[model samples]
Target: METLANLESFVRSAEQGGFSGAARRLGLTPAAISRNVAMLERNLGIRLFHRSTRKLTLTEDGERFLTAIRDNLEGLQAAIAEAGGERREPAGVLKVSLSPTFGTDHILPLLPDFLKSYPGIQIDWQFDNRQVDLVAEGFDAAIGGGFELSPGIVSRVLAPAHIIAVASPAYVAGRTLPLDPAGLGELDGIVMRSDRTGRIRQWMMRNAAGEEMAAAPKETIVVNDPAAMCRAALLGLGVTLIAVPDVLPHLESGALIRLVPKWYADAGPISVYYASRTLLPAKTRVFIDFVADHFKRQRLAERFAGSLG
Candidate 1:
């Protein structure tokens, strides 16, 4: 009979792609992980992984074994955690990825109350604009927009990710207001160069009646960060397209004004993403529910819709 430790070592090594990576996740030494895997292979009389200086790949039998035991392993671990009273009191390092501006302005404010409710949970949050590989990087969850959903990942829509044209009150004070998306070309446009594609992004603006027109800004001032673009617009540099959530405070305070109130670009949903597992950690499960509830309570979805006139 294979020991549970041997099975765990094998599974984690396969998922992480090497003994060293598995050791980091499981808090075991790489040699210990390797020994356990070797012992498991010896007992089963079959090789599990093809080892090399550069990489580790699973053998055919190993792949089949991993498929059969992966879900069961997670379930077993979850069950053990539950038996040890973890289900009643969720406790762990809750690692989450978030966009810097939105996470600071919105999600950070909710942490106090969450911490109060779950004293056992420790938060390890990474704030960055780039999309992250959740499984590869070992994140418990991520909150952002425009991430491609990879295999074994799931998302819950938190809000509409809507982009709208905005300009500072000073910039638009004497300029002729644009009637449609095509008129936006006349203004000096503050735009963003895509970090992933290295190109200036184009917006396809839509009206209330579902009419679509493309807006290609003049690209007078190019920026990378959304907040920086908003700041540039605030300095009366140019008109810029930005997400509603990123510019809501400015709009509300009269620092920035909407260029075309009826026009917006649908950028899809701002979502909370997590690994799709049969048995999620208690901390992760509660955190997801808490965030969703908070969004609903605050009417953030409506606020982020970019529908304000």
Candidate 2:
């Protein structure tokens, strides 16, 4: 009898044409996949793959072995699933990436309920602001706005990524409220500078009536991060434009107030993205549905829509 892990690893590596892809699909490390293949090869006393620096090629024996096992692999897996009760219960580490503040503020709260519902599934959340290569990085899913829709990747939109001007109530208490975006030039601006491009970010505010105008405020304080900009505004430094999701709690708590409430800038939709496959792994599939359900139940689509103007 052959070890199931060794057999599965060999078959998956052959099908995927690389250990990395097989590892990603199996939720194992690439080194682990390679070790399993090596073990299988040693057991059979045959070199299954002609490994190279760039890619692996199937040896003659490898091709024959694949033909022998390809049709039976799924059946074997299903049999094992039945024995282990995995068919009914999804179990695995669900690796995901998301922005730090958003993940902490929104997604982290769902963990307790998620863990209770799926005890077998472990959460491995990576908080980051940069766009990551989902497939190459082997991430099960990612949540953010402005991700480039590369091939094989699909997005499930959660909310509108609309930017609205905001300021702490203390900062605006005595200051004359900007009647229009043009009047923003009169106030000190705690503006965002793009870290990647080294450029000051700017937005043309638009209202429900379709009126548009420049929103350049006096560049009093410059920061490269959204969280920092929010902090600056909270400290009564000046008003800053920000996404509604990041500042929703403060707004509700009366710590922050919406400025130029009628005007907003469309930044795009924040979406949950994952690889598009015919049969997604059980853990990944369940997680995707769970997030979508939460977003719908919370009415986040409506609450995060700053561009409703």
Candidate 3:
């Protein structure tokens, strides 16, 4: 197959009627243009030019080849320019993977405004708990936490993934509020078991003053999913350790209150992941920027920090 450079050079030389003129247009030396055309001719096993000192003329085969490739060449150039992030009108199906709960709570709400601003782009968002293979699965972007970074994947931290103890007001109505993490051991725990290891999940809680302790609540109810555990907590089943985003609405609405407020379990970060930082498509880049901007503008990091309580 001929390279893009060779095809471009041959077409440019044919259009200009001389290698020197093509070279000037393409910002290449005349010798470079001639070599590219020659390489392309060899690759195609046909002579495309009748070369002379004064001018370049197309051979019979060259005329047919030029006609066939002229329109296609313009399309290829447009595609290349778009791929290089030169697209003014970004329009395409943006396939993104997101954690179900977090996606619904956080990113999904921004969709109406996002779609309003970018009417050309269509969203194909998948809400799942499992970590998706971004490049292998052909995803444009993903947002959540605990994604194992593969080669070419990059993450931008949007908020602190802090697991704070929360229980519905009805559950904790008459019960004494705990002043520390260890006091959680006395409460009925709506704990989650790891689906991967089939083991009970435990956390080491930390505070802003560098204090660390175990937050092992009584294993009264066990589930495999964080969302389930969160639901149980909200239902007034028991106190559970959950990420801030999962219960931010409830916390704000006075449905659930933080227990042992000064301590939280650090679960890395909630990040927006993509294939590359510099070579991202326009739609993906803007989405990442939009999510990050909202997170910052709303001060989600500070609000999500349980240690400050």
Candidate 4:
């Protein structure tokens, strides 16, 4: 009879295309993967892979066997995990990715209580602004806005990622307030250059009266990071459009003021993303519920809407 280790090695090697790649994914050495596959082939009396120095390709029998087992692989793993007591307690490392500013400002504050409640679970969190491949990179969950959802990934909207024009009180003190988007070009503009596109980003602003216009300010300073743009505004360098959540505290503290109170850009929904599975691990399941509840209890959806007068 073939063992689970042999089957897993075969499947992972087939998916990864090489023993070395499978080793990385399964946390086993290439020799172990090779040995397991060899043992399985010996047991079955058939070669499953066409082994080579350059790449590993499946044999005819291997392709058929993979088709039969691939659909059930995740379910089999879940069943094993449940039998090993994952369903009873969240006791494994939970890997998550999040944006630096939002995670620090909002999600980081909730960790104390979450950790207190689920002490058995360890958090491995990465802060980044780039869209990550959740399944390929092995992230348990991710949080941010404007992620393109691939197959087998799910997302729950946490809040509206709305952008609004903000400036330090001193910056706007001597300048005339912009009554419309067209008037914004007269003020010194602090803007962001896209790291991916290398072009200055523009904002499409909408007012409360259902009027829309493109606000492309004359750039005085260009930045790549959201936090740095806010800092530049704080130093009274120029007016900048920023996410409402990023500047909410400053606006409330009177450090930053909304230039056009009714105008905002609807970027998209800030979301919590995870792999779509019928049986979610307890750690991932609890974290999702906790974050959703936190947003609701704090009224972050409304506050971060950029509609506050």
Best TM-score among the predictions, by candidate number: 1
Ranking by TM-score, best first? 1, 4, 2, 3
Please report, as a residue range, the 10-residue window in candidate 2 with the lowest summed lDDT: 78-87
Runs in model 3 deviating more than 4 A are 1-87
Candidate 4 ranges with C-alpha deviation above 4 Å: 1-5, 18-36, 78-87, 208-210, 307-309
> Candidate 2, residue 240: CA error in Å?
0.5
| Per-model root-mean-square deviation over C-alphas | 2.6, 3.8, 12.3, 2.7
Quality of model 2 by C-alpha lDDT? 0.88
Residue range 148-200, candidate 3, lDDT tens digits: 99865899999888899999999998988888989999899999888778899
TM-score of each: 0.88, 0.82, 0.74, 0.87
Q: What lDDT does the true structure give each of the candidates?
A: 0.89, 0.88, 0.85, 0.89
Per-residue lDDT tens digits for candidate 1, residues 157-270, read 999999999999899887899988899999999999999899898999998788999987798999889889988999999999989999989888999999888899999999
State, as a TM-score between 0 and 1, how close model 2 is to the true structure. 0.82
Q: Considering lDDT, which of the candidate structures 1 and 3 is the better prediction for this target?
A: 1
Residue pairs clashing, model 2: none
Weakest ten-residue segment in model 3 by summed lDDT: 275-284
Clashing pairs in 4: none
